[model samples]
Target: SAVISQKPSRDICQRGTSLTIQCQVDSQVTMMFWYRQQPGQSLTLIATANQGSEATYESGFVIDKFPISRPNLTFSTLTVSNMSPEDSSIYLCSVEIGLHYGYTFGSGTRLTVV
Candidate 1:
């Protein structure tokens, strides 16, 4: 199993600004994913990060708005760009530990855009 550390547990930001969230895994992983959970809602898949290649984003999520970087097998980052009040949500990072072990998720970064 792999342990993940996500930065800036929570933040309050201006509507027009951007924020970058970082996810670091203790062990190397082949599949890492980013998700966003709105208030009182289910988790939504934002993107998938594979080492040495560009991230693949889900519908309604674009590279320009939610840029991702997977520099290696153990680290990745997600940036919420040109943020708006509607963008306020809980951002999380997850990794598939294995088929048997299931998945592990970060503590989550709560962003509130005013």
Candidate 2:
């Protein structure tokens, strides 16, 4: 099983400012997934970060707005740029922890844009 450590559990930022949240997994995961959960909506896959390739983002997300980095197998980072009130959401990282079990998520990073 992999344990994930995510930082900046919550933040309140100015409208134009940006926030970078980091996720560190205990073990190497072939792929790490980033998701956004809005106030009243379901989780949307933001991107998938792999060790040696560019991240693949979802339909509505672009690299310019939601850049992701996976320097290695166990670490990754996601930055929300030019944030606005509408961007407020819970950002989480997930990876399959075991064969029998499913994905396990880190403590989400909750952002509030003002």
Candidate 3:
């Protein structure tokens, strides 16, 4: 299993402002994903981070709104740009350990937009 350290456990920002959340994995991983959980809602897949290449975003999510950077095998960053009140949610990063071990998630960054 890998340990994920996500920074800024929580934060409050004004509307239209941007916030960048970082995720650091203890071990190298091949599959890393970013997800968003809105209040009282299920987790929605945001994008897949590929090392040495651009991230692959899911439907309804564009790279302009949520830019992901995967600089290496163990680290990545997701930025919520021009946020609004509707964007307030818990952002989490996950890594798949394997078929048997399953996936591991970060503590999550709780963002509140005013």
Candidate 4:
């Protein structure tokens, strides 16, 4: 029911820097989620961007480190603040419509902090 478009497909930044990755959906969605994936590893859910409420972060992930905003139904943004080498990973945006429609994701933001 939706397609996602993410900005800054990849980036390399210095330590202590910050990056904001955006996700745009083709259709209205009730939910949006941010995820991170390391090389050769599975995706890790970062947080859920609520329509009218603060994002719910997963364990070991906090809002201060990865802040998210969902101002409307078809858009959301995730900011990775204070980058570090250990923060290098692929950040993704996902949206699920229904059981039949399944989930769709953006191309992803590959970030590397030196």
Write the residue-wise lDDT of candidate 3 on 1-114 in tens digits.
Answer: 889999889999999999999999999997789999998899999999999888999999999999999988999999999999999999999999878988899999999999
Clashes of 1: 0
Report lDDT per candidate. 0.95, 0.94, 0.95, 0.94
Question: lDDT tens string, model 2, 1-114?
Answer: 679999989999999898999999999899999999998889999999999999998999999999999999999999999999999999999998668879999999999999
Per-candidate count of clashing residue pairs (backbone under 3 Å): 0, 0, 0, 0
Off by over 4 Å in 2: none
| Candidate 1 lDDT, 57-85, residue by residue in tens | 99999999999999999999999999999
The alpha-carbon lDDT assigned to residue 103 of candidate 4 equals 84
Please estimate how well model 3 matches the true structure, expressed as its whole-model Cα lDDT.
0.95
Q: Looking at candidate 1, what is the lDDT of residue 51? A: 96
Q: Where is model 4 poorest over a 10-residue stretch in terms of lDDT?
A: 96-105
lDDT measured at residue 56 in model 4 versus the true structure, 0 to 100: 94
Checking candidate 4 for backbone clashes, the offending pairs are none
Estimated TM-score per prediction? 0.97, 0.96, 0.97, 0.97
